[model samples]
Target: MSEPVVGLVVSHATLAEGLVQSVRQIAGAEADALRALSNEGCGPEALQKSVRDALGDGPGIVFTDMPSGSCAFAARRLTLDRDDTAVVCGVNLPMLLDFVFHRDLPLPELVDRLVSKGKSAITGSCREVAGHGDRAAAG
Candidate 1:
């Protein structure tokens, strides 16, 4: 098999580490390919370098906690000229779990699957779960 697609999770404070820790706790061996970086004391340039050093030369994804946050900005900047890597915002436990298991897939395919898995993991409201609009309103 080819080299597994690794991931660098970047988040504010200790969020990144917490997510990676959770993945390690739950996924065990499968979580080996994922790492974490926090933007706690790092500025844009520093964050960028930290991410760059962590990623090196490899086909991987950078998972950011927010779409418009420092982590996302840094990751986006670092990967602008690279095709082997991609930046994924809104990092979460479900997404990380998906990444750990499906790392062997091609980069593009892996990105698609990770995004899909991440989106699918999001859910809210019991009313929405049951039904919405006229049907739920009447019932």
Candidate 2:
């Protein structure tokens, strides 16, 4: 069997850690396949080292909170020469949940699905729904 794909969440401050905790609460046992790292007070070099240490030598995915921030930059730098690595920025609960469910997919396919799911999850409410109505309209 193929080695299981690993997941790494990288973000500024405590976002990465918090997201992982939330994922654990929501996903239960499935969240065990993931890890989180924060660029709290570390420089690029230190952050890169942390990511590399987390990644080890296996096929993995890195999710960042920002596309151009330090976390994404470090992740991009680390995966630049490695085909087995992929970095998906703008991570959210939807994306992480998708990863939790789809971590066994091939690296490239998983990255594609993550990017699509993450983008699709970002939406604006245009009208009232069954359980979700605009509070301003109600008040």
Candidate 3:
């Protein structure tokens, strides 16, 4: 069997830690497949080092809270030369949950799945609720 893919959550402040906690709460035994990194009071270089240290030489996915933020920047910088690493931005609970269930997929396929799932998970409240009547009524 293929080795299980590792997950790295990077975000500003305590967001990464909190997200990992939520993942652990929901994922149960599968939580060991993931780790979290916080950029709180840390410079870009420090953050990059931390992420690299967490990743080591293994295959993993880095989830960032924002596409244009430092966490994403660090993640991108660290994974640029590595084919075994992927960075997925705008991470939410749905995306992380998807990763927990599908981490065994190959790196490229897993990245694709995460990007798709993350984008699909963002929807207006009306759209999120099926049979919620007309948009005007919902508003």
How accurate locally, in lDDT, is each candidate? Answer: 0.87, 0.86, 0.85
lDDT of 2 by residue, 23-134 (tens): 8888883644889999988999999999999877889999999889799999999988777899988999989988888888888888899899998887665544534653
Instruction: Give the distance in Å from residue 99's predicted Cα in candidate 2 to where it truly belongs.
Output: 0.5
Distance (Å) between predicted and true CA of 40, model 3? 0.8
Score residue 35 of candidate 1 by CA lDDT: 88
- Number of backbone-clashing residue pairs for each candidate, in the order shown: 0, 0, 0
Q: Write down the worst ten-residue block by lDDT for model 1.
A: 130-139
The local lDDT score (0 to 100) that residue 84 gets in candidate 1 is 87
Q: Which TM-score value belongs to model 3?
A: 0.85
In terms of lDDT, which candidate is stronger, 2 or 3? Answer: 2
**Which of the two candidates, 1 or 3, achieves a greater TM-score against the reference?**
1
What TM-score do all the candidates reach, one by one?
Answer: 0.86, 0.87, 0.85
User: For this target, which candidate reaches the highest TM-score against the unseen true structure?
Assistant: 2
Candidate 3: list runs displaced more than 4 Å: 126-139
Instruction: Report the C-alpha lDDT of model 1 over 1-139, residue by residue, as the tens digit.
Output: 8778889999999999999999999989454498889998898899999999898787889999999978999999988877789999998899999889888899889899999989888765676557654353332
Candidate 2 overall lDDT versus native: 0.86
Candidate 2 stretches greater than 4 Å from native? 30-32, 126-139
lDDT of 1: 0.87
User: Which 10-residue window in model 3 sums to the lowest lDDT?
Assistant: 130-139
